[model samples]
Target chain A: MARHIYSCPLRWSDMDAFGHVNNVVFLRYLEEARIDFMFRLAPGDGSPSFSGGSVVARHEIDYVRPLVHRHAPVTVESWVTKIGAASLTIAYEIKDPDQVYVRASTVVVPYNLAEERPRRISAEEKLFLQEFLAEEPAAV
Target chain B: MARHIYSCPLRWSDMDAFGHVNNVVFLRYLEEARIDFMFRLAPGDGSPSFSGGSVVARHEIDYVRPLVHRHAPVTVESWVTKIGAASLTIAYEIKDPDQVYVRASTVVVPYNLAEERPRRISAEEKLFLQEFLAEEPAAV
Candidate 1:
């Protein structure tokens, strides 16, 4: 399965007083990458018109190394790990070609905002996600 | 053991497009509460001058319910779940008078900024932390 790669720009303010990217900011980067993967790319590939209208049920993140703000961008590699009947798990790595700064996973549940409740994954959405499905990540 | 209670003020910008407090913002609240627990209160107990010169090694956060913007502040209750030689775990709950919004835990490793290395829990620091230690939280 193929992984979605997002070239994430780093904001200078992302770094805290410690001169490194704050742990909470790393989750923002993951959200950006996940949005790019699920919202931007998925529907563009001739799948359903559904976007990333979902809720983050849970998140597990590991900060492998500290990241300092730099001019160049870091790459966030994301792929589907588990797709359940109503939810899906995505794993990601924010890294450079040489080193990984963070490894993380998020559980997402599709929601029907108009109805004010979560909805099950549709057949077409599952098929779209299947293309990027990798049950086991190499490292993350 | 006493749990650290922090009244976290919610910013209007903390909400995402969904009009609820974003999941990432919950982590920021946790950070605020942790700083209060580890930095503001720890050394002030007449223990050593060791503050929260620590790094977040890992975080596991579960969003139990959605919260919208409000004038009143939410409460973050933090407690020690495990204290190891080099690291400790902090479990927290972001709640209000009647409901819990999030349940999370973080593994933190104390670091020596000048020496640039992880350090073991000192005797004084351990004693200070022990006062707040509760191995098993009611439902973190």
Candidate 2:
């Protein structure tokens, strides 16, 4: 099993009136991490290809602790937890160097843009995802 | 049970590469609706009051359909699904005039920001929340 970790920068606008990172802002951090993971598998060129795009069908997030504004960058650890024929699950851990702030999961379906429908993961794409697969459960 | 529905304007930046609302942007819409619902309960007059401030402890979202960019506003319907001693639940639906796009729930904990701690819902606050209490389950 392998993991892909991304370092996400924090912007001042991410904070709410309470001086903590707004709960909704965490989703953006996770999105960046997921995009990084996917692109790592198939780097985007200037043109489109047969590589299937994906859409999030579901998301679950548990906030372990409130993340206050800080100078340090946050790390988002993500890995594929399961890969069905047409969908896959990605699990994530968001943390600063000192503490974990969130644990989350997203269910993503392989999508066909031209057909406007979901499609099964190609053998090649599934092999690519296997490189970052984790044996652990999708949620904590 | 009463429900508070908010009309949220869509920003161009909210769209991702897929030409649809990014999965993460939906959280911001839900947050906006939740804030409007709370402020309606206890309008802020520049002073602190016992109508406790809240923090999101968890969020679960199911994407019923992808939302495409449009000129019209999106509607977010929010209601209080449960109120415990120190925490409450908010359910939401994101939709346009024709169809539903997302169903979501957020678990929120009442907090005393000045004291930096979770606090019980005051009797008055509890009574106010009862107006929006939803007898149905949190999500569809």
Candidate 3:
């Protein structure tokens, strides 16, 4: 089971009045990690890389701990938790060296942009996702 | 039974390679709407306004339609759905007069940041939240 980890830089604007990183910013960190993973599997030249357009069907995030503002980058670790014929579930964790801040998952569906509908994931793409499939379900 | 609706401004940075606002940015929109509602209830001078601290326990978003980059602002309509002694649920809809782009909900808990634990919501705060309680659950 392969897992991808990306270092996500934090911005001053990402902090909320609580002096901790805003909950919304965690999603951006996960997005950066997910995109990095996707591009590695299906490299593109500044164009639509996935077999078809991909849209996030749903996102669920559970905040475990409050992350404070820091100059150091936080790590976003992501792996495919499940893969269906037309959709895939990606699980993510935003963490630092010591503690995990959030656990999240996003359901992404292959979409046909021109037709504006859901589409099937290509066999090659499925194989790509399988390469990083988690051995077991993500505990979140 | 008052509902708050805010027109959120979009920035180019919010757009992703998908030629539309990234799913993550929708969370930011919801945050802005939530903060506006909070400020209206408890006014503070650029400091912590909530009694102690309110942390997002969880966030769930369902993307109804992909929002493309537009010059105009998108309206985020929000109202409280349920309130407990320690937590409350907020429901939101992102739209632009014609179509709804997303439906989302977040569970927020009154937290004791210094103590690093959840705290009970105060009576005064609960009273403030009740002012904008929704009559029924969100249809989406």
Top candidate (TM-score): 1
Docking class of 3: high
Predicted candidate 1 versus true structure: per-residue lDDT over B1-140, tens digit per residue:
78889999999999999899999999999999988888888864333334636899999999999999999999999888899999999999899989999999999998887788888888777888888788765654
At residue A51, candidate 1 shows an lDDT of 62
Write out the backbone clash pairs for model 2.
Answer: none
Ranking of candidates on TM-score, top first: 1, 2, 3
lDDT of candidate 1 over A1-140, digit per residue (tens): 88999999999999999999999999999999988887887653333333636899999999999999999999999999999999999999999999999999999998877787889988878898999998766654
Per-prediction TM-score: 0.94, 0.89, 0.84
Best by DockQ: 1
List DockQ for all candidates. Answer: 0.96, 0.87, 0.81
| Reference-based lDDT, residue B88, model 3 | 92
- Could you tell me which 10 consecutive residues in candidate 3 chain B have the lowest summed lDDT? B43-52
The candidate 2 chain B region of ten consecutive residues with least summed lDDT is B43-52
Writing each residue's lDDT as its tens digit, candidate 3 over B6-95 gives 989999888987688988888989988987887555544135445446788899999988887878899999998898988999998999
Shift in Å, residue B12, candidate 2? 2.5
In model 3, the runs with Cα more than 4 Å from the true position are A43-52, A112-117, A135-140, B42-52, B112-117, B135-140
